[model samples]
Target: TQLLEQSPQFLSIQEGENLTVYCNSSSVFSSLQWYRQEPGEGPVLLVTVVTGGEVKKLKRLTFQFGDARKDSSLHITAAQPGDTGLYLCAGADGNKLVFGAGTILRVKS
Candidate 1:
């Protein structure tokens, strides 16, 4: 079975700080996606990385896919309180999606 493990399950930082979170797996995936979720809401797709070593940026956020396609990372620059949310990494396996344990981030103003 494909599985993803995310590091630092929880985080707390001040506004304007930067942080990076990681997702790792032993199994290779055809594609990987990142999502962000707010309290009481479903996760919103942030970006999708298909090729190995691919990187995508959205404003202050950066996503990277490992060269082996088994890992990924998310970096936030000058985070704001509004950036606080649950971040998740998911891998595509056939018709199914294998998700990581998700990282919860809190940015205090």
Candidate 2:
């Protein structure tokens, strides 16, 4: 079985702060996907990294997949209050998925 572990269960910051979140596992997966969800809405796909050591960017956010395909990270630059949401990391192996507990981020203005 594969499991994803996320760190810094919660984060609170003022506007324009930068934050980095981490997801880790001991087993390798075929691909990794990141999602960000807001209140009253389902998670929306942020990015998917399939290759080891791959990096993807979305505006002010950066995502990286580990060299061993067992870990990933999300970095946000100059975060805004509108960035408040829950961030999740998921591992895809074949058709199955292993999800992390999640990281809740709150940016105050």
Candidate 3:
């Protein structure tokens, strides 16, 4: 089984600051997905990157897939308090999908 390792595990930053979280794996994935989960809600899909060296942006958030498709990163620019949540990375290869431990972000106003 393949697993994703995410770091630094937890992040606390002031509003308007920029931050980056990472997800890495020893195995390459066909596609990678990023999700955000709130207090009482299920994780919501943020973005999916399928091609190597691909980059996608959603407003203040940016997602990037490594050239080998074994790593991914999420960058938040001028993060707001609303960005505080659990960030998860999931990788899919054929019929299997694996998720990282997740990074909890706390943005203070």
Candidate 4:
């Protein structure tokens, strides 16, 4: 069985602050995808880190996949109001999918 867990189920921040969210698991994953979803809208693919120990950066956001392929991290630099939303981490094993508990980020301006 594969499962993903995220820390600090929720987060609220003032505009311009920074934050980090974590995802962990015991089972190794083939690939992992990170998504940010806004209210009333489907999640948008923020990034995907497939290689172990690989890191990808998108503007103020940075993502890293664990060397063991069982963990991941997201770092937001200078968070703004536009960054507020639900962040979801997903692990894919062939056609099956497992998701983290989810993190709700609120950025107040």
Best by lDDT: 3
Q: What is the TM-score of each candidate against the true structure?
A: 0.98, 0.97, 0.97, 0.96
**Cα shift from native, residue 109, model 1 (Å):** 0.3
In model 2, how large is the Cα lDDT of residue 44? 94
Q: Name the 10 consecutive residues with the lowest summed lDDT in model 3.
A: 92-101
The 10-residue segment of model 4 with minimum total lDDT is: 92-101
lDDT of 3 by residue, 1-109 (tens): 8999999899999999999999999999999999999999999999999999999999999999999999999999999999999999999979666999899999999
TM-score of 2: 0.97
Task: Determine which window of 10 residues in candidate 1 has minimal summed lDDT.
Answer: 92-101
Kindly indicate the candidate among 3 and 4 with the higher TM-score.
3
What local distance difference test score does each model get?
A: 0.95, 0.95, 0.96, 0.93
**Candidate 4 accuracy as lDDT:** 0.93
Q: Per-prediction RMSD in angstroms?
A: 0.6, 0.7, 0.7, 0.8
Ranked candidates (lDDT, high to low) = 3, 1, 2, 4
Over 1-109, each residue of candidate 1 has an lDDT whose tens digit, in order, gives 8889998899999999999999999999999999999999999999999999999999999999999999999999999999999999999998688999899999999
For TM-score, candidate 1 versus 4, the one ahead is: 1
lDDT of 1 at 46: 95
Clashes of each: 0, 0, 0, 0
lDDT of 2 by residue, 1-109 (tens): 7889998999999999899999999999999999999989999999999999999999999999999999999999999998999999999989887889999999999
In model 4, which runs have C-alpha deviations exceeding 4 angstroms?
Answer: none
